[model samples]
Target: MATQNPPVADIETAQISSQTAQAGSTTGSWANGAFQKLKSNLVFRSKWAELNGAMGDLGTFIPIILALTLARDLNLGTTLIFVGIYNFITGAIYGVPMPVQPMKSIAAEALSDTNFGVPEIMAAGILTGGILLVLGVTGLMQLAYRLIPLSVVRGIQLAQGLSFALTAVKYVKQKQNLPKSKALGDRPWFGLDGLVLAIVCLCFIVIVNGAGENLRRGCGAAREGSDQRDEDGDVEGRKSKTARVRKIIFSLPSAFIIFVLGVVLAFIRRPKVVHEIKFGPSSMEVVKISRHQWKRGFIKGTIPQLPLSILNSVIAVVKLSSDLFPGKEFTATSLSVTVGLMNLVGTWFGAMPCCHGAGGLAGQYKFGGRSGACVALLGVAKFVLGLVLGSSLAHILNQFPVGLLGVLLLFAGIELAMAARDMNTLEDAFVTLMVTAISLVGSSAALGFLCGMIIFVILSLRGWTKDKPFSTIWTDRSTPEQP
Candidate 1:
């Protein structure tokens, strides 16, 4: 027996081998599970998903891209690559058609201020990202969400929707005026080429939405049918499925088709003499920050955005995610962290400050994006465009008719506002209306939140508010005195 126990080292070697095998098995099992989950979640069955996902942030993207490239002279390639990478990561992590949008306050201020440049924008982004990262990591984002009333959040969404719709109308009018331009020459409807396309796209959207509702009703009716009518129920269900498939196949690609047509028309009118696009790695510029730049960024850029980020980006987006995709528990912490990380990484590369947006979420969800594949597809497109087109992206996008973009924006805005339809109580309606009014007038979500809070405080003090947590003086009068 002593001889059989040749060496203790041999026993240890066998044990190590066994443990290694177990670990490998466990890792393989996990990998398989993750692969299966991803497969189930990634849906690219329809063309509309890709189109909607790309268009989700066009409202903000168009302006920001132009501002940075045309005005600030930032490297367009680096900006797009940053956006693309972040978008892909967001979609992969969330497994939903979530959005990565430019920070509106930062973008707007950066574009408008002659003094503000890439350095200032980067500083602002870094500052905002640090603030949000701390908030998310420490769990203060959830606290902020709890402190605000739902009605106030709804009001913000409403105000944003109205603003987007108004912007869409302006775009439509601009396209309408294209006919009068001498460059295009005199044509019918003043050469309002994009208007017709916009109308067609709008009609397609309405039809698809209507069909979705009908399919739901048909399924319900079929389920309610008697066992004896099983055959008829099966026939009805099949019809609905066929109709849905047809709608998906035909309507989903309308946006891309229209975009392509616009590009073609653009080339015909003014052809690109250059035969080839230069392909190269994107440029990343170093941000040079000064004390004055830091102060300006903090005051003009980061401070104003703090309220909106809390309300719209975190709270409102979380609510929309739950409403649109039930069973998904989207928390403020996750969203805040995502926004912070996006900006922190993107700004260093001279990308625009980016964050998750409620409007973008609504737009993506409305246009048939059930899973992350929509966003991933868009990310791939953007990444390729950055690599291939780079600076020429402006020319390509410019060729896209503004009127079509308007139609998409209008629908997205409607989807956002429609979310507030559930606020039926009289008090909630009043609060929402007050907040919307203030936001519309001020053109600032932060101002609206403050005004709403003040009004709520006043109403609470007078015992006129619905949410009364404190005991009134009159109620205390009826209580017995303490010993």
Candidate 2:
């Protein structure tokens, strides 16, 4: 039966080839698509989105904490101006869109137990920014990052997380007290009350988690069946599912609802402490500094902090390169040049020293931000918040019960810290921990970086580790003995 080759064989071969081609095309498309999406979505388009999202999440809370800590000690108006100017300059220049609202730690330093006013701190930030700009321009910043190792960075992150967590706990305890001064002229501690509130909040979070799980399961089941349909239909179905998920995750309405609930809870509790906190004005006078003060601010701010800022910038470039280009050598010197230039541009207008803000970047990625658009959206939103809130937003935050703010901040800090867990290797873990520790312990991020680098070098030299260098590494290994 010389029935030549069966027609089925030909068809089978053709199908196999088609499948291979389809797979190759899909993989290529996905790679291109993810990159394109990242560039356009988060970095470019979502600047305003990130800004607004962060503001709604914890941007507002950060400033308020600073205000409360410094209210009795500093000129609220002056502090507001300082923060506003710094934020404006940084946002305009570095394109890193993080909210540089006043930090609680800075406020604590300036307030001291004794009376030292906002002017000093404002002076400090201005000085820091100026120094950072100069260093960045001069290329000192790059050197700093190169010196630090991955282990130190990890440590720093871990320490920072702990500090943030402790801060949250302190605030929660403070929130429980009655507004009235105690017999000893000290504020009453509300530790017990805070614990209860924390529990309740946790319960609420749990409920939300359950609801989310149910929603995901339902959606997945729907998608699985829908994919069996015609090609066009499946595509449309997938789009619909994506949109639904996004709506659930980033919907302003949902946030508003939570906010409203918070407000209602506040009213019902009528926490007395809210009334005691001094609030800043909704508007602030823009003080034009005399050239002498400006010069002083620049000198004082930039000179001391310049070293740290540069190091931070270098670390940022290294981290970004590793993430964006795995298994590829990235030039730390080039990254330093780019960041330094950006910092210089930012400091011209009194902006905060801008760096990679690894924590912020990670959060954006987790939240589905992909491109520059996402980052840009964040910037726009921050600008708008600054404009709309003017100065009063800081005050409004102070008026909220401390417990409420504490809970919110606690979650945010945890989220930021959790990013460290993503670093799989021991060396990476060490870097994060060291960076965090240095930032917290020294209260100087730059110093922490320096310490981290020393550790990394020691580990590397011992041959206990193997990781690519940010710049380049040359090694002399004894030639293997001839076999």
Candidate 3:
């Protein structure tokens, strides 16, 4: 009987080991198969430039989306899926590196509270979207676009751009208010995501940007060398070698590399995050928005969001797209229609409310996003992450190095701000600067917009064109000898 008991125990242990090994093998095989399929399909599929371009807007997207996810106002997976679909659809339709960003005003309002009342956010989004859709379909958006001065639009862009830059700087300096994440509030200068690391990343980006110019120069130099070879039969030497090296370096995706490095660092810092990941997507639910929530959402979130979306999202984005892609005709109506539809469908399911933004567009374009493929691929990545990782991404994102993000955000901000450079005239500059200043000072885009409109109206009424002097408003004969 004792010998039989020993055999039974041994058999049970063996059975347990076999089951564990089989389970492990099944998971390993599934992962290997997926990776193999992906690699096979990507042989001729994803271009390095497009892949690089795909990460361009992530600096802006990550912080906002992460904040919302942390606050529980937005579901990480649902938001990603919705925004991902939006990106893909827009990419296919617009064929440009179009941007879809969280509605900043609503996000701000929601994030101001502790829990952010998801229903309120949804209500605000639905209302705002409905209004935008009405305006777009009826051509009222076009009318609004025509009414707003270019200077005012540029002002909003300048403000948003500069604001992004300032926030990014804070993120880099590690002085941002986030005391919970990676000693950021302490402003550490020596550790991972420290000031030193940030500076290095910034320098790398500069070199990468300069490398493109160098490549151009190198190509020209190579051509010259070719010509010289043809003329004098001289062989190319150091310059050609340098050009090839620079090309190789630039071929390495700058944004993606840094981003991946940050993510890797995060995982290294917290290995147990692997165990936290669940296999399935987060559960999606229909949020219950009460009448009270709707009213509150309207008053707090919608009112503020409406002006920002109308001006920045629709008007400024249209202006920017035209300027950036001169041949592309992006209309305010189309933009409004898209924004309206995005929220109308997604927010009810607790997805983040989103809109177009000039800053995001400029940032993406400034990086490497020349075509829709950049964002389309980005969208696919987002959808996969959503379906696979779900809210587990929150922990990873929460751990991502803020300093690296800051460097990305800084460049994006500068790129967006550069768009305002075309307004070189005095009156236009005055309007743009004032709008930006007031917006930053008041912390209110609506207020700054009002101030900008007032200034523009006064200037327009006073005949404040380049040739018209301020003193000439009352005088039939104004002084013009100063030039």
List the global CA lDDT of all models.
0.71, 0.46, 0.80
> Looking at model 3, which ten-residue stretch has the lowest summed lDDT?
213-222
Tens digits of per-residue lDDT, candidate 3, 150-213, equal 9988888999999999888888886553322323365677776678888998888776654232
Q: How far is 320's C-alpha from truth in model 1 (Å)?
A: 0.4
Candidate 1 stretches greater than 4 Å from native: 1-31, 45-53, 175-188, 192-197, 210-251, 273-277, 456-483
lDDT of 1 by residue, 1-483 (tens): 355655899989999999999999999999999888677556564555455455655655664575567677767787778888887887777778888877878777776677878788888888898898889999999888778788888899999888888877666655423212112322233343545556776787565443332222211122222232444657654545554455344344444554556567656645672443466656556667889988888888899777777788888998889888796677899999989988888787777787888988887766656677777777877788888778666655555566666777777787788778878987678888899999999988988988878876676566653444556565665788899
Off by over 4 Å in 3: 1-46, 175-184, 211-239, 464-483
**lDDT of each residue in 1-483, candidate 2, tens digit only:** 676766998989999999999999999999997666444333433333333233333423343434443353333333334344444443333334333433333344433423323333345454554555455556665565555555565555555546556666666655422112112232243432345655565455433222222222221122222234433666544556654554444323222233445555554554564454444333443334555654554454444445444443345535543653254344455444444444444333323333344444433332323334434444444455555544444434444455555555554455455545667887677666766766787877667766777767776765543554533344324345467
Q: In model 2, where do residues sit more than 4 Å from their true spots?
A: 1-52, 56-97, 103-105, 113-115, 173-197, 203-257, 263-395, 422-447, 464-483
RMSD of each: 5.7, 14.8, 17.1
* Model 2 error, position 7 (Å): 77
TM-score ranking from best candidate downward: 3, 1, 2
